[model samples]
Target chain A: MSDTKPLVDVRDLKEYFPIHTGWGRTLPLKAVDGVSFTIKPGETLGLVGESGCGKTTVGRTLLHLYKPTGGEFYFDGELVTEKNMPSLRKQMQMVFQDPYSSLNPRMTVEDIIGEPLDVHHLYSGRAERREKILSLMETVGLNAEHATRYAHEFSGGQRQRIGIARALAVNPRFIVCDEPVSALDVSIQAQVVNMFEDLREKLGVAYLFIAHDLLIVHHISDRIAVMYLGRIVEIADANELNNNPIHPYSISLLSAVPIPDPRIARSKQRIIPEGEIPSPLHKPSGCAFRTRCPYATERCAAECPELTERSDGHLVACFNK
Target chain B: MSDTTPKKAPFSMQIDPALFEPATAEEKKQQEVMSESTTFLKDSMKKLMRNPLAVFSIVVLAFILIVIIVAPLVVPYGYSEILKYNGMKDKTAMNLAPFQYSANEQKYMAENGVTLFPHIFGTDELSRDYFIRVVYGTRVSLAVGFFASLIVLVIGVLYGSISGYCGGRVDLIMMRIVDVIYSLPDMLVIILLSVVLKELLDGSKGIIARLGTNMVSIFIVFGMLYWVGMARLVRGQILSVKENEYVLAAKSIGTSSPRIIRRHILPNCLSVIIITTALQIPSAIFTESFLSFIGLGVAAPMPSLGSLANAARQGMQSYPYKLMFPALMICLIVLALNLLGDGLRDALDPKLRK
Candidate 1:
């Protein structure tokens, strides 16, 4: 990692959604609980987890899109409070997960991408605004001719690029990319991922790349953070975490990834966890993963294991690890 | 040779099939939305042009409007003018058939060596030109329909946007008010109000007197009752459309609520608004005709279509054609508006787009 101060430093963010059953009674759905991470000026942090593990919520919270139910977000060493959200939005933007639904159908490509510029007043005149919008589109590899087109006229990959261009319009330092390429065809995924990498290098923007696909995350992330039911199970350097995942949950997750070599792939064991994930409403008393953990013991049930550093800059949440 | 010289590159390098080359300039014209800028409305308008029934309806409505507006200016007789010359009633002209002239007119024309003009649709029992009366009746019905629908549109859009976008307590309170209004006996109230308003506006001055008491009362009833349907539709549309991801995206971009509601939410709900408003015109026209049938519409001599039909009913056995002209005009207008409404719904719907 670089020695420079982190561009985005988030500590112990908690987002609890209230579910109203009836008549003044409500239940708390802990979407993100005590999550902590930091991204340097140009670093990419990959967030990987299963569906409904609150991966998207983390990205949303960092950008202050959702009013963080509880957390401290420091963007470039300044605290991100509600009062500053309007101004801070210029420095931080987001690329949504579903490219199909994200862009407004009624708006033209020029207007979609120009909205950020319109919001920030980045340019002096109409010509300058058009120039900036066209340049942003070019950065995302879109043709200038695509400006007048509507969202439905474009393919899924092209639509994603329009979204990326919109995000880049504000010239943000960090962007929270929530599965920006997941909605594309598998063949088109690689092309989009390559463009993302190219744009990252060209623009020097950091990202919290959230996705459920481990392989896609592994390709572009500088560091990897594994989340299980809204809590970080393990976090480490990209190569270190892949080669040596400390948490039992991480080990099981990493093992699920298919190996190309036939001999080695045959030798690997598939550790599929038994039973469905326990509901967040009725989570296990201590050690939320213990319900499906093969090595569950009375000790795990007695105490909730906090994330502890096992080695230099490598953190794991299991007591055994 | 391999050691001494540089190795030749693969043949595929010069003709890379897998390279990320964009399409050539020649093929750019084939791209969708490439020719010129077009909005959802403009695109929908183009689609509307393609629908034969809708186009026919538009032409029909335009023709009716032009005739109603222009016919009175060129036609010599007033709709209510009792046939007379100088201070004497031309009694012989009463109940004359189309193309038939009075004896005096024919004799005067023979003396002057010129053709005497005939009443195109003949004369009524009161010896007034039937064609001009029918035209004036159409004008009255069209005006009432348009004004009523305009009132509904203005009130409904404002009320619905506030109710749906504000949400929570405000929405609940506003919606309950709508429910209360919806459940009320609307027609009865309209009838009562019409009676009361006519009494109040009777023989009034300026625009009120010009519109006549019944027309003014019809407008009031429209303002009170017709807006609820439009409001509910707009509210429902705003509720769903405001929840879309694009709305959230707009919010995340730091857009204010009012601007978002105007630029994003309202434009998205435009299809629903337009369809409802178009349908409202026929509905208001029907309501006016119904009220007029019961002797509650525009006062006599103003000659609304319903009044004309009512006037013709007394002598239906003698002059059946008198009732047919106004009745046919109403039928044609209502059918045209209904087709146009259906066409607007199909054209403007975002989901139906390719």
Candidate 2:
């Protein structure tokens, strides 16, 4: 990872959706606020957060899927703005969640995968295009016969593979896998995760793999970034973060994962956080997680914590940490 | 032989021997692969084909259309020709019928056999055969309905699709115009416009004279007036479909707006448009009939269903046979068309099958 340059650099990115309160007034819903990350060539950065923590919004904003309300995004060390978005999009692609709904049902699988090729003009002729599509399908473990079928005919895993093929058709250097296997069955999820690993090995592509499954993220990611309420609570090397999660949110999330070993599981205590995630429309004053944090102090409410690196490479964002 | 011998490779490098061997316990418990051939369209078509009532209605409508198309050739006498039975005493056949030989007619002409030969549906007060007039009139009713409805469809699709696709201020302005037009009674507009057009084209001797100077012009006037509602329906469908994820995907991929509309949005709205077209055919036919009945339709000598019905209504009290035949045909035709339309509505309803 150190030998290659960073493909994407995101700093303090924020996206706030307006919540209309009738009579022409609207309040801002801070979906992604002050989120920072970077992806090196041939590296996968896992973004794990509970529902509504704005992890998906971060992926979208990095690719400029939604125009950012605030912050800077640099692609290949150059600042990515709306003006050069089309060209930047050619380099950066996204694989959306819900593989079933992401691909157009009306379009054939070939057309779906061929769309990017058509847009980019990568092929010399129709035969070359067909050969490329077949090779791509083979790379993703799909048959040549499946090219003419519609998206609805494929299984959830196959659909995600088709989506991966579409993203790869542009020969993009970077990809944001936004919960690619979240909608698939548990058995299918492993196949998709393995496929992602294979793609990284074969193409040397970088990915910001967004998923709530810590186990899967740990298996595939070099580093993990844990988020809570639009802010990343912790980020560190995968093994280091799993061993010593200093943030209260990260600690609770790690504690919830059931161990496969009965002896280890019997000794470990589960730290289940109480209550639900707060609405972004009316976020708490200081630390957004203060409402559900077990270690909340009077100071935690008065001041927001800044992320600081510990002795190892693990970064924690809490006053006590 | 020794030099050409193949060396045995390591188990890891060779293709997995487990696949050629027996399956593992773990592999055996995996979910079975379900076939993925069934699609939305096939499922819908299957459901539609199973519906006996819809099939029956379609058959009836086809039969009616066939009758309408061939009515002229099948009928023996011309519409305006007087069919006199007693050779020259045309008065005897003023209000005649079949299966009933006129005694006075029998005494005048013993050569000509029966009164029924000349008048299949019998004659009216003018002694013109009712059957021949009704048959010829089918042509006028059908032509007006078909041509006018087509005009409405084209106008409606264009207006609605544009307004729906480019939504916001443009949509607001277009819809406001639609609302204003919709507020007025459709029938009144048809009547007023036809009357004015008829008056304007009267006494003009050119191409207008060749085609019923007033009739062709009135049909055009009515067709233009009927497309507003259809446009509104199409616009409503387009508004909903445009926000779907596939549309967003197309936009993200840098597909042009027109291509997105033509390929994605328009195809999604086809079911609604087709079902509406079927239903509107009867409406167009009814509108033409009403216009002719009120004496604002086709001019004298050229028979239409409405004009025939009008003539029938005049002599209904005395020569009742004149009114009954045309009225019956109108009811049967409209009823059959409406049933066919209902069947099509079910066939095209996506939610009904899937």
Off by over 4 Å in 1: A1-3, A22-24, A261-263, B1-45, B85-116, B199-213, B345-354
| Per-residue lDDT of candidate 2, residues A191-309 (tens digit) | 99999999999998899999999999999999999999999989999998898888989999999887866668889999888898899888888899999998899998998887888
Q: How much of the true A–B contact set does each candidate keep?
A: 0.38, 0.19
- Scored by TM-score, the top model is 1
Instruction: Please report how far candidate 2 places residue B344 from its true position, in Å.
Output: 5.5
All candidates: TM-score = 0.90, 0.81
Clashes of each: 0, 0
Tens-digit lDDT track for model 2 on B192-306? 8888888888888977787786567766775677788889999999999887756755555555678778877887787778777766766776777787778777877778887
Residue by residue across A172-202, what tens digits does model 1's lDDT show?
Answer: 8998899988888988899989988998998
Q: What DockQ class does candidate 2 belong to? A: incorrect
- In angstroms, give how far residue A120 of model 2 lies from its true place: 4.6
TM-score of 2: 0.81
Clashing pairs in 1: none
Model 2 DockQ vs. reference: 0.23
